[model samples]
Target: MHPSIPGTTPDTSSTTARSHPKHLKRFIIGSVAVLSITGLVAGGAFAVQSAADSRERVAATRALTDSTGLQRDQLGAYAGIAEAHTDKTASSTLAEANQVLASTEGKADASALTAVSSSLASFESMPIDLVVELTIETQTETAALSAAAAEADRVAAEAAAEAAAAAEAARQATLATTNTPAGAKAFAQSLASSNYGWGSDQFSCLNQLWQKESNWNYQAYNSSGATGIPQALPGSKMASAGNDWATNAATQVTWGLGYIKESRYGTPCAAWAHSQANNWY
Candidate 1:
């Protein structure tokens, strides 16, 4: 054993100093590991925050774009609804175009709105009233023309009907004349010769007169009470010839010849001349 010296802590401090290096190394290593872990956790947290921020920014941008699209779509729908008016109020078209311009608001750019406004102005500047009036006038004129054409067609149809009726009447007259009895001419000739002293020269005149009056039909009747081949006024006047005057051509001819000879018309030719001038003998 060694005796202690006063006021001297001896070399104990040196031994402690030599031993402290290992503890210091261990503490530094532990501190470095803790700092590394803290750095890694901070980096991960920063990355997560950045990603969240980026997503939020994208969502915000998309929301803004969608809002703009919705605004534009609503504007277009309003414009479409306003554009379907016509008739006498054609100026409503300009009103609708103006509405389209008003609907653009914040959704469209200034240039786009200006273009739409210009179009509306141009539409409003046009003479819509004049166009409507002109259209009405044109329609009126067209209707007048159509009516005139229809009238012309009606007139043409009426004229054609009248002509057809006249032709049918002429055909009936011809048929009646062709149906004359074979003995009618001979009977007329015999009666004219015996009673009126008329020869073959008067035969033609008698034939023309009888044909014009009754188509040589003994039973023929006229609206004026005239009847038989001579178309005598009052069919009963032919009864002087015979009771069968209406049915017999010979009886009708005998009575007619006697009447011509006794009256102012002394011959068939004179009676025919009178009939030609006055449509009656």
Candidate 2:
């Protein structure tokens, strides 16, 4: 209550004080709204970033799965070749790779996938060298076997030729002793027994038959065109036994025995009986 100055008569201190509180309340509400909007925007950005990270992880897992499948297929093909060659080292590596692939199946862990991929890379080239070596070895073994077979065949052919020459010389030596008439008779007896399966009893019949035909003489010839020890229809007919049929008693005897056995007589005794009955057998 002092004397009024020029234009200061009102005392509105209480009103100013009340208005200050209202302004404070409005400022508080606006600040709260601004903070709420900022929180929503921040949350939305974080959620979008999180979703993007999840998509990247899914793509990485898919890529890893594809890579692992391709690696497994290549390893399986190599393993088949290794097994065919009976290579134990390559087989072991393939087994280890399969185990690693099995452990990482359907997994999305990046570290596990990386480990498996690394293992596969390390194992990939291991079987290649072994396969190449095995292929070379197989080819070499095949060549050696072929060479050995050819050599064996050559040796067998040489041995067969030598045996044939030895057999021919022995036959020539035996025929040289049959030039005389007594030796020719003895050779005929031996030939009838060994070649015709005829014993002494059948030999008696064969001897009588040939003696009547040619006097057991390989040089005998008939005016009717029969010749040789057994009186073959033609002298050259005994050439079936040897080229020296006219002179070799063994040759003529061999042909005579075969003729008696083959001409439906079956034995020299049977031929003798037929000759006695028909006079032409």
Candidate 3:
């Protein structure tokens, strides 16, 4: 049995309220823990800032390089970070990096230096470590590409040279074994009788003196400037036949016929190819 109060009716609700109070106390403890955690986190961040501010630029660079040094890519990244800090004098990050890379010497580690330069070149924008890795990879690839292109160019140039030499040799051989003026008459006569191309027209006017003197001597130079079988006064007048017209009959005939055609249409039927092929008429 319960003991009864003297005046107020005994309130059973008070017991219920007391029972819930423990849960409220637990919530207060949890809030306090969250506040403590937040304070610790903020304090830690301040400490890190103070530590960073205490180091010199060179020391900072060394630290970065040391941390990432073990990683193939990370070392390069650290090197870049060092470079970025190296240019303390420059206004921009990259400019500052440039300054360090330029001024750092015996104290500077070459591998680290290279990594810094390589990484810096690769970045449009990025953290120093990643920039360095990108730079190293890109430089290696670019060098390889350049070497391949140079090799290809060398091969192409050699082939072109060989081709030019072959063409020159053939041209010299043609000149060495060309038909003489004496041979021209017999060849022309035979061709004339046997439908000598182009309507078999009479080139008799051109054939008159050539039959006796040069006989179609393309190399017939009077050195005195009397040139070709037709022997035009100036010798150079027959140059239309070939650039070697003065020394080559094939050249002279080419020029003579060209003169006749351009000045006289096809009435004489002098063609550049026919003259070269048959030697003359």
RMSD of each: 32.9, 26.8, 19.4
Tens-digit per-residue lDDT, 1-281, candidate 1? 22323422122221222233432221111111201110122212321223333344345434543755544335334333333222324445334434544553343333433443343344323333333443344444334444554666688799999999999898566445433655677767776777667789999898898889888887788788999888888989889888877766777877888898889988889999999999999
Best by lDDT: 2
Which segments of model 1 are wrong by more than 4 Å? 1-179
Residue-level lDDT tens digits of model 2 in 171-224: 788767775567778987888777767899998888788878888888899999
Ranking by lDDT: 2, 1, 3
Better of 1 and 2 by TM-score: 2
Q: What TM-score goes with each of the models?
A: 0.36, 0.40, 0.47
Residue pairs with backbone overlap in model 3: 77-129, 87-96, 119-132, 181-215, 181-216, 181-217, 218-248, 218-249, 241-254, 241-255
* lDDT score of residue 196 within candidate 2: 66
Error of 3 at 121 (Å): 8.6
Top TM-score model: 3
TM-score of 3: 0.47
Clashing residue pairs found in predicted model 1: none
TM-score, structure 1 vs. true: 0.36
Question: Candidate 3: misplaced stretches above 4 Å?
Answer: 1-122, 182-197, 203-205, 222-224, 262-281
